[model samples]
Target chain A: MTHQDRGAADGTPRLLRSGALQLETGGRLPEVSLAFRTWGRLNPDGSNAVLVLHALTGDAQVADGPEGAHGWWRGLVGPGRVIDTERYFVLAPAALGGCSGTTGPASAAPDGQAWGSRFPFITLRDMAALEARLLDLLGLASWHTVIGGSMGGARALEWAATQPERVRHCVVIASCAASTAEQIAWAQAQTAAIRLDPAFRGGDYYRHDDAPRVGLGIARRLAHLSYRAEPELESRFGRAPQGAETPLGSPDRQRRGRYAVESYLDHQAEKLVGRFDANAYLSLTEALMSHDVGRGRGGVDAALGQLDAVEFFVAAVDSDRLYLPGQSEALAAALPGKPGVEYIHSSMGHDGFLTQAEQLEPQLRARVFG
Target chain B: MTHQDRGAADGTPRLLRSGALQLETGGRLPEVSLAFRTWGRLNPDGSNAVLVLHALTGDAQVADGPEGAHGWWRGLVGPGRVIDTERYFVLAPAALGGCSGTTGPASAAPDGQAWGSRFPFITLRDMAALEARLLDLLGLASWHTVIGGSMGGARALEWAATQPERVRHCVVIASCAASTAEQIAWAQAQTAAIRLDPAFRGGDYYRHDDAPRVGLGIARRLAHLSYRAEPELESRFGRAPQGAETPLGSPDRQRRGRYAVESYLDHQAEKLVGRFDANAYLSLTEALMSHDVGRGRGGVDAALGQLDAVEFFVAAVDSDRLYLPGQSEALAAALPGKPGVEYIHSSMGHDGFLTQAEQLEPQLRARVFG
Candidate 1:
C-alpha cells in the first residue's frame, strides 16, 4: 500500500542493492536496488540466458501470474510458449522507474525517506546500463537474446546500440529508435494530467490522505485509448450505451452512466489505479520522452550502424497507432543488415505486440532460437 | 463576460430562442436558442447566401478578427480568400451546446439561472435543425453553398442528407457521413477527463471559484495533439527541449517546465480555458459523438444516397489520423456522383482542412463554386 512496502524487497520480488551508479542525466546515485524475478535456470556457460524487458507500467511478472495477478505479456512467455521457459533462462526486471518492485521515485533515498520529488530523471540508456549490472550479478556474461516491446524495446535497442557485444540477439517490437515529438506531446499531456490534479501535490503525495487517483485515472484513460486502434474501439463498443443506462442526465443533474467505450476506459483506469503509482508513471514517461537511441551517436542510422554484432529482429503491429508500423520500418531500415520489419496483423493496435504473440512467435523463433 | 451578454440580442451577434425543442435522446428543451454572425449581403432570393459551420469549440467566428483575436479559419476566410467573404453571404451559428454567444450550459434558462448540468444533450441533426430555424429568422430560403471542416464537416454532411433542398452545393472537409467508432472512443476519453476533474462538479461548476480548468486543459491537450499529425510534430520539435529549461526536476519536486511540443499544447489549453466553458465543451463533444448522418436514415449508403438534390464536394486531409481520408472516400462513394476524395496534402493532419486552404483553393472553387 505504501512506497516503502514495495521497496522493502518483499521476498516474492528479490532485491539487489547495486553499488554506486551514475545516471545519463549527469546525476549520481549513492545506492540503487532493483527488484527482479527469474524464470528457468542459467546454464553453466550462460549462453542460454534470455533477458525479457517489460514495457511502461508492466512489471517483472512476464508470464507466471498465479492467483489473481495479471501478467502483461502472458501470451508470449511461459512453459512451451514462444519464449519457452523450459528451454531458455528468462530474467525479467522491473524497469528503473517502475513502481512494482523497482527503485523508482517511491523508493527510499539514502536519508531513508521516500525519494519523492528528489529522484533524478533517468533514461532508457540508464535502464540498459543498470540492467547490465543486474545481468553481471546473475553471473551471466552475455544474454543470448534481449527481447522487449514498446519502452522495453527502447532498452533492448539501447543495449544493442551502446553495447552489442554483451547481447547476442536483440528483438525490438512496436518501438522506434527515438520517441517522436508527437509521442512526447502525448507523454507531456499525460504527465500534466497527473501533475495538475490537486491530489497529486507535486509528486509528493505518497502519504497523502487522497492520492491523485482521479488524475491517474484520466491519464490511464488517455493511455488506454492510445494503446488500441480506433477500428478496434469502433468494432468493440461503437455508440452503444453501457447496459440499459441512457446517456441522458437532467438539466439539474450530471449525465448518467456512459457509452460502452467510456465504461471500458473507466475500467482500464480503475485497474491501474489500484496497482500503479502516479509518480512512477510520471518518471517512466519522462524516461520514455528522453528515449533517443542516437542522442550522442550522431543520428539513428549511425547509432544502429554500431550494432553490427547484435543479431536483430524488428517487429511492428500493423494496426498500431501509438507506435506506427512506419516506425518499425524506419528502425529496420537503419539496422545493421537492413532487415525488413516483421508485421503482426491485429485489431489491437500497439497492444498487439503484447497480446498477439502467436503471430510473432515464428518470426522470433527463427531469428533468436533458430 | 456573462453568458447573457452574448445571449442578449445585440446587432453583431444575433440570438433567437425557439420554443419547445425536443432532443435526440427524447429529452425536452423548453427553450432553445443559438448565437450567430453573418457576413456579406444575402441576395433577394437568398441564392448568394452561404452557410458556414464551425467545428467543436468553434463558434460563429468564421473570419474577420479585427484585433489579434484568433479566428479558427482566418487565413482562408477574408475579402478575397478561399471563402471570399466579400462575395458570398456567409452565416455561421454557434452550435446549440456552444459557449460563445450561444445558449448552452453557461446560459440562463427560463428560471433565470445558469442551465449548467441541466442542459439537454443535443445532436448534430438537432444542431442542423436549429440552424435551419436561424436561417428562417434571417428570411433566407436556401443556401447557395454549405461548407465545413471536422465537426462542421459533420454538420455539413448532415445538412446535405437530412435537408438537401436547403443546400445547393455542399463541401464536406475532413469529416464523414457518420462518426466512426474511433471518433467516439476519442470523444469518450475527453468527456471522461472533464467528469474526473474534482472541480468539474458534475457539470455545475459555473459559479464555483475553481472550474475544472485542469481537466479541461487535459481534454484540450488530448484534442490538440490529435488535431495535428505526428510526423509534423517530429519534424517541427523532434524531442527538443523548450529553450534551455530541462525536462528534469528533482526527486522532491515536480517537473519544472516542458519540451517545446509540451509548451505548444499547454498554450493551446490555456487559450481554450480562458475563452471556453467546460460544460459547454462536454455538451458539444457529445453532440459530435452522436454525429451519425446515417441515424434514422438506415445506413451510411442510404443516408448519403438521399442527398442527390445537393451537389457535394468531399475533401480529406491526406495526413489526417482522426478522420481518415478513407471515410471521405466512403462518403463520396455513397453519394450519387461517386466523387473522388479531394486530398489536401499537408503535414497538418486534421487541421489541414482549416489551415491549408491555399492548397485546396482551386479544387474547392472548381467543385463547390464552379
Candidate 2:
C-alpha cells in the first residue's frame, strides 16, 4: 500500500478536483472540488474503506490532523479508538457548500468570481453523489461503513438510499429521514437572520470589507440554543447574571448587562462568526432544509425498502430536541431489517451525537464496524 | 352600584392618569397612565373585584368590547363563563411597556414626544405594582383573585409575592417563579433580531417612515415556534410546500417559495408587525428576561414562603416546551401550601394556555374563582 500525504503541512484539507456535476435540483456545477482528510492505508482492493461525514459547520478533521491538531471526533476515530485507524482506511470530507476548503458559495466560479448569489441550490443527495465521485477517483468500489451524526447523518442516509449497492453498513445518528416542519422553521429563522443583515448585500458581500458577522452571530446564538438541552442550560447557568453585570436594575436598557446564558450564547455566536462564512451557512442550512429521502421516491418507507443491500445501525440522543429521538425511531422502523435504535443517554440535546459518541463504541463495534 | 362606560366609543382603551410612580429599577415615571378595560359593575366595598393580567403582547380587552370586538381571552372571561363578569367585576389592563394604549416606548412623554429610546427598564413586579395603583384608584384595596398565564402568570406570581395580603388568590398558568436560563437565551435571540434591524434606530424608530417590522417579524417567527410543539407542527405541516409554490427545485434561492410551516410563521409575523410596536416588544421582552419573583426578596422558596396569605392555583400545558410543565410543577411545589399542578392536556404546546383555556374551566371554577 502506498502512503500519500493526504493533508497539507499547514493543516489545510487536501483538495480533489472533479468535473461537472449534475445537482439533484436540476442545476449543475460546472466544476466541483472536495476537501478531505484520510487516515491509515487502504488495502490493495480498497474493500476496507470507511467514510466519515461531518455535521454543519464541521470540517474534514474528523480525527487528529498534522502536528497533533485536535479534531471534533477525535475520541471515536483515532488509532486504538472505536473507529481504529490501524484496522480500517478512514476518509472524512468537508461537506459541499461548506466553508472548510470545500466548493461552496465562497468558491470561485468558471468566470473567476465567487459563486455568491449565482450558486445553485444543492441537496444532501447531491452531496452524497459528489462524495461517491470522489470515491470513484480513489478506485474504491464500496465502503465498509458510511457513518455520520446530525447533518452528517442525513448525508450518510442519503448515501445508503442513493447508492445502496455501494454501502455495506449505514449508520445514522441524531437525524431524520426527512426534515420535519419544526426543523425547517428553525432553519428559516437562521437563514432569515443572515439575509436580513444589511451587510449581507444579497449574498454578494465577498467584495465588501465587512461581512454580516452580526447577523451570522445572531443565527449562531439561536442555533446553539436549539443544539442544547433546556435542563442542561438551567443547571449550568440558571438566570445568573454574567459576572457583576446586572441583567436588571439598570435605568438604561442599553446599558444593562447580559445574563450568563446570554453571555454564553454570545460567545458561541462570536466563535462561529470568526470562522464561518455567512453565505456558506445559508447554503448548507438550505440544503439541510431540503433533505428528504422520500423526495421523488414514493415515501420514506419505500425509499428505505430499496436499501435492503445496506445493513442499518441507527442511534438517537435520548434528550435530543432538534431532531427528536422519535425521528430516529421512525427511521429505524422504516429500515429494511427494522433495527432497534441504540439510545445514547445525554443531557446535551441534538449535539449529544457528537459529545456522547463514546457511548456508541460498543454498539458500533458489534453492529456496524464488525 | 352604578355602571360606567370605561372604554371609549372609538374602541380605544380607557386611560387613568396618575402621579409620579417609583419603579423597581429605581427609575421613576414622572407621570403614569394605565389603559384598562372593565366589565360588569363594581359592587359596594369593591370586594367582588377580579384582576386579570394580560400576557406580553396582550391588551386590555379581556372580553367583547363595545360594538362586539373580540378579546384574546374571550372564551374564559365572559358574562357567564369561568371568570363570570356578572358576579365578579373583571378588569384587564394592557401591560406596561406594551403598545395597546399603555404607557410604553410609543407613548408620549412629558416633552409631548414618544418615549422611544428614553423608556426605562421595567420588571414584571413593576407592572404588578402599577396595577396595584390602578386598583387603589378604583377604591379596591385588594383583589378577590389575580389570574394570568405566561408573562401574565409571572406578574400574578409577583403580585402574590410582593403584596400577599392584597391578592386573595393567585392563579398562575404556563409560567415559572423565575425566568429560566433557556427562557433568557430565547429572549436574547428575539431582542437581538429586533435590535439588528436597520430600521430599528436603537428603539427610536417612531420617527422613521419604516419601523423595524422586518426585524419584528423575524422575532415573532422565532417566538411563535417556541410557543408551539414540534409534534403539533409536524402533524399540521410535515414537509408540505405552500400552495402552488415549491420550497425546492428553484435554481435561484431568492425565487424559492416557502414551506407550509414557513408561510404559517410568516402570517403570524405579519399579524404581529401590523399591530405591535418594535420598541415596545423589546421593552416587554427585556422585562420578561428580568422576571424573578424572588428578586431582592431572597430565593424563590423563601419568597413563596412569605405568600402565606395568598391561596395559589397553578396549571401547566402538558406539552409546553417553552415553559416546560416541570417548571409549573416546581413553582407549585415551592408555593406556601404546595398546590398540586393542574395539567391542561393539549398538544398545542405553550399556546395551550390560550387555545386550551376551556379545559381549565372546571378547575378554575372549583379551585380558583370559587
Candidate 3:
C-alpha cells in the first residue's frame, strides 16, 4: 500500500535504487532512484541491449504493456515492429527529474519530505550519468544502440559523446548538439509561466491543496504549439470555432467561446497538467536548456570529432520549427565520419520525431539495430 | 494635473471626446475618447491627409515631435522620410483598447470608475470604426493612404474592406487576411499567462497597489520571442551567459543567473510591463484574435473583391515566422488586382516589417504613397 509498492502490484515500471549521486554542478543528491521499464531479456553478452531515452514530459513507458495499453512510441518499439523488441533487450528509464515515479522534485528526501524546492539542479550530463549507473546495476556493459528524439535525442547523443565505447550506435532525431538561443528563450517563457503561478509556491507545492495547474497548462499549450507544424494546425483547425461555440462578437470577453485551435490547446494542456508535476516540468526544462554536448570537451565540432568509435545516425523533421533541420544537418556534419543527415518527412513539426518515427524504420534497421 | 490636462501642456497626444460609440460586437461605450497626434497641416481639399496606424504596444506618436522626441516609426514618418510628413498631413490614432493616451480598461467610465472588467470586447473592425469617427471629427472625408504593420496592418486591411471608398491606398505589411490557427494558439498562451497571475483579479486590478505585472511580463516575453527571427537570436546570443551571471551550476534555482537570451527577454518584459496595462494587453490580444477581413463579407476573396477601388500594396518579411511570407502571398493573391507580394529582407523576423521597412521605399514610393 506504500508508494514504492504501488507500481509493483500493477505491471508498472520497476525502481533502481542507488546511493548518493554527484551532479555536474558540484551538487549532490543524497540518494537516487530511477523508474524504468524493460522489454525482452538481455542476451548473455549484453551487446543486444538498446537504451531508449524519452523527451521532455515523456515517461519511461515507450512501448505497450502486456495488456496492449498504448505507449507514446508504440508504432516503432513493439513486437515485430521497427525496433523489434523480440530480438533486442529494450530499456526505457523515466528521466531523472521526471514525475513518473522517478527521483524528482515530488519524490521523498532524506528528511522524509518531498524534495520540492530543495531538489538540486541537474543537467543532461548528470541524467546520462545516472542512467549509466542504472546500466551498471543491470549488469549491462554496453548498448547496441542508444536512440531517441528531441530531448531524448540530446540524451542519446550525450551517451555516445561521454561514453563512446559503451554505445555502439547512436541515433539522434529532431535534436541538436546544444540548445539554441531560441530553444532557451522558449524554455524561459515556459519556466516563467510556471513560476508566475501563485500556486506554484517557488517549486514547493506538493503539500498544497492546489498545484500550479493553470501555469503548467499554459506551458503545455505553448510547448504543444511548438511541437506541431503551422500548416498542419491551419489545415486541421484554421479559424474554426469549437463545436457550438462562437469565437467572435461576444460583448463580454469572459463569456466568449473558444476557437477550435484554442480548444485543442486546452485539451493538450489539461492532459499534461493532470498527470505532471510543475516542479518536475521546470527541472526537466532547465536541464534541457543546459544541454550542450560540447561543454567541456571543446566546441561542438571538436566534441563530436571524438566520437569515432560510435556509429552515428542523425535525423531531422523537415517541418520542425522548434529544432530546425539545419541543426541536425550541422550535428551530422560535425560528426567524426560526417554522416549524412536523415530526413523524416512530416507535417507534425518536432513531434514528427515520435509520430513519423516509422519513416526512419529502414534507415534505423540498416544503420542501427541491424 | 488631471489625466485630461496632462497631455495638453506637454505637446503630447490630443484627445477627442465623443458620445456613445457603437461597436461591431453590438456593445456600446457610453462615452468614448481617442488620443491622436498629427504631423503637417491639412490641405484645403483635405485630399492629402494620410492615416498612419500603429501596431500593438505602439501609440499615437508616429513621428518625432517639435521637441525632437523619438517615435516608434520615426524612420519612415519624419520630415523627409518615405511617408514624408512635410508633404502630406499624417495622423496616428492610439488604438481603442490601448493603454496609451486613449480611453481603455484603465480609463474612467461614465460612472467615474475604471472600466476594468466592464470594458466591452472590441475587434479590429471596431478599432477602425473609432478611427473613422476621429476622421469625421477632423472633417476629413477620406485618407490619401492607410498604412500600417502587424496589427496595424490588419486594421488597415479592415479599413479597405469595410470602407473602401474612404481609403485610396492600403498598405499592409507582415499581416494576413485573417488570424491563423497558429497565431490564435500563441495568443491563447499569452492571454492565459496574464489571466494566471493571481493579481489579475478577474481583470479588476486597476485600484490595487500591485498590478498583474508578473503576468504581463510573462506575456510580453512570449510575444517578444514570436516577433523576432530564430537565427537572429542564435547569432546574437548563442548560449552566452548574462554578464557575470552563470546560467548553469547554481544549486538554487532562484540564485541561478540567466542565459543571455533570458536577460534580453527579461528586459523586453520589464519595458512593456512598466508602461502597459495587463487588461489592455489582454483586450488588444483578443481583438487581434478576432482579426478577419472576411468575417461577415462572404470570404477573403469576396471581401477583397469589394475593395476594387482601393489600391493595395502588400508586403511580408521573408524571415517572419509568426505571420509567414506565404500568408502575405495568399493575401496578395486574394486582392482584387492580385498585387505581387513585396518582400522585406531582414534577419529580424516579423519585426522586419518595422526594421527593414526602408527596403520597400522605392516600391512604396512608386506604388503606394506616390
Candidate 4:
C-alpha cells in the first residue's frame, strides 16, 4: 500500500495534527496530533457519521482496537447494535489529554521529546475544540450524532453547545453540565494520590521504569468505589476475607491476607497500571475538572439553550451517586423539549451507563438514533 | 493528693490494668490498661452512672481531654446538655485499640517497648471486653445508659448484646448491626493506604521521625469523603479552586494549587496526622471492620435480638452514605419492640451523628435519657 493509503490499514491509529493548538486557558501547544480509530465507512454524503466519545482513562478504541481487545462500549456500538456501524460511520478519538496513541503529555513535542511536565493546561472546552478540529480533518462538516457518558458526556454536551450545527444528536449519560464540588473533590483526591507519590517527580518520570504505580493504584481504588454502588459492594464482598485468609491473626498474617473487596480493587488498580499512563490520568482528570458547558454562555440553562437544533437524550443511573439523577433532570429541563431525565436502573452505580446496554438499547434506538 | 484519689481528679486519665488481655481471635496482650475520664459523681445508689463511648478517633475525654481539647461529643453531653452530666455520672473511655492514654499499639508492652508492628489483631468484641473490664474496676455494677455514635455506637450495641443487664439503655446513631461490605471495602482501602507506604516499615514505623503521613493522609481523605454527603461537598466547595489558585495552569501551577475541597481534606488529614497514631488508626479501623454483631449469634437479626432487656434508641443520619439509614432501620426492626428508626436530618452525612446534636437532644431527653 502507498504511504497515504497505509494510514487506512485495519486497526491503524490515525493522527489529526494542528500547527499550534491554543487552549481555553492562555497556554498553547506548538503542535498537536490526536490519535483515533474508525469503524465502518463514511457515507458519500457524510451525513451518517457518528462520534463516539470515551470517558476518563478510556482510549479511542470504541470498537476493534489493536490486539483485538474488546472496546469499552463494544456492546452498544457495532454491526447491528444500538449505534449500528453497519449503517453509520463511527469514529472514536482518543481525548486530547489521553495517553493511548494520542498527543498527550507522553507524546513527543515538536522538539522530538516527550512533553513530560511541559504539557499545556487543557480544559474540557479545549478538548472539545481539538476533537472538533479532528473531525474537520476527516472531512466531516457535521456529525449525525455525538454519544458519550460521564467525562465523555461532558465533551458531548460541550460539542453540542459549542457548535450547534455540527452535532445533530447528543446523548449524555450519568453526567452533569459541570463538575460539581463533590466531583472536583474526588478528582482532587485522586490527583493528590498521584502527585504526592515521590515517584511522580512532578510528572517528569518518563525515564523511570516505575511510574507512580502506588499513587495510581490509590487513585483507581477511589475511583472504582465511586463507579459502583455501596449496596453492590456490600452484597458482593462485605467483610469476607479473601479465600481462606482469615483476618484474625498477627500483623504478619493480616498483612498477607485481604478483604475480598480490597482484592477486587487491587485487581482493578493492577489492570490500569499495566495499561494506563499516570500523567495522562492527571491531565484528563484536570480536563474533566474544567467541565463547564455554561462557562461562556450565561449559565447551564443558557448553555443548553444554545443547543436548539441538536436532538438530546440525557439519562442518569438510579444508583449513581457520582452523577445523580437530579443532575440529569436539570440537564433535561434545560433542553428544547424540556424532557424528563430517562432512567437506567441498575445496582451498579455510575458504571450502569456502560453495563446496562440492553436496557438502554430501546431508548438509544428510539430517541438518539431511530 | 493520694495516688488512689488522684485517679478521681478532674480530667485525670484513669488506667485499669489487667495482667494479660486475651483477644477474642486467640491473640493476647501481655498487659492492657484502659484510659478513661470521668465527670460528675456516681450516686450511692449507682443508678446514675452513664457510660459514654467515643468514636473511632476519639479519646477518654468525652467532656474534656488533656491540653484542654474539647471532647468529640462535647456538644451532646455536658451540663444542661442532652445527657446532662449534672443528673448522671459520665464516663468516656478511650477505645481499647485507640492511642490517647489507652493501651494501643502506641502503648508499651511488658518489655517496655512500643507494640508497633507486633501489636496483635483486635476485634470490636475485644474492645467491648476491655471496656467491660474497665467498667468493672470502676466499682459500678451496671450503667444506667451506654451512649455512643459510629465506633462508639458499635461498642454500645456490643455492650447491650454481650452483657444485657450491664447496660439499661443503649443509644446507637449512624451505625449498623454489622459492618457492611461497602464499609469493609472503605476500611480495606484505608488499611492498604497505610500498608503500601514503604515508610510504614511493616507498621513498625514508631522509631521513624515521620509516621506514614502521606498514606495516613490518603486514608483520612477517603474516610472524610465517606463521612460527608456529596451534595454538601458540592454546595460547600463546588468546583471552587482554593483561594487565589485557579485550576488552570501548567503542571507547576497545577501542582502548587488545589481545589478548596482538597484544602479542606488536607486540613483534616493534617489535623489527624498530628494527634492520631497510624497503627492505632489501623487497629481501630480493623476493629470496625470486624464489627458484625451477628457473627456468632446467627445473623444480624438474631444478634440484635440479644438486647432483649436493654431499652434501645436507634437513629441514623438522613444523608449518611457510610452507615446508611436502611441499616439503621434494619437495626430498629430487630429490636425488642421493633422500634422505628429515628433520623437526624442534615446536610452532613455520617458526621451528622456528631454535628446535629440539637436535633437528637429532644429524642434523647424523652426516650433515651428519660
Query: Of the true interface contacts, what fraction does each candidate have?
Result: 0.56, 0.85, 0.85, 0.50
lDDT of 1 by residue, B153-249 (tens): 9999888877888888898999988776678767777776777788988778877899988888888988988899888888888878789877643
Please write out the lDDT profile of model 2 over residues A283-365, one tens digit for every residue.
89999999999999999989998788999999999999998999999999999889989999998998888888889999998
Candidate 1 residue runs with Cα over 4 Å from true position: A1-13, A26-31, A65-71, A109-113, A248-253, B1-12, B16-22, B26-33, B65-71, B74-87, B248-253
Model number with the top TM-score: 2
DockQ of each: 0.47, 0.82, 0.76, 0.53
B115 Cα displacement, candidate 4 (Å): 2.2
Residue-wise C-alpha lDDT for candidate 2, range B305-369, written one tens digit per residue: 87888989999999999999999999999887888899889989999999888799998899877
Better by DockQ, candidate 2 or 1: 2
The candidate, 1 or 4, that scores higher on DockQ is 4
Per-model chain A TM: 0.94, 0.97, 0.96, 0.94
What lDDT does candidate 1 reach at residue B222? Answer: 88
- Residue by residue across B316-358, what tens digits does model 3's lDDT show? 9999988999999999999988998999998999998887788
DockQ of 4: 0.53
Model 1 residue A346 CA deviation (Å) reads 2.6
What docking class should model 2 receive?
high
Residue pairs clashing in model 1 are: A117-B250, A117-B251, A117-B252, A117-B253, A118-B251, A118-B252, A119-B251, A251-B118, A252-B118
Q: What TM-score against the true fold does each predicted structure earn?
A: 0.90, 0.97, 0.96, 0.94
* Range of the 10 consecutive residues with the lowest summed lDDT in candidate 4 chain B: B1-10
Give the lDDT ranking, best first. Answer: 2, 3, 4, 1
The whole-model C-alpha lDDT of candidate 1 against the native structure comes to 0.80
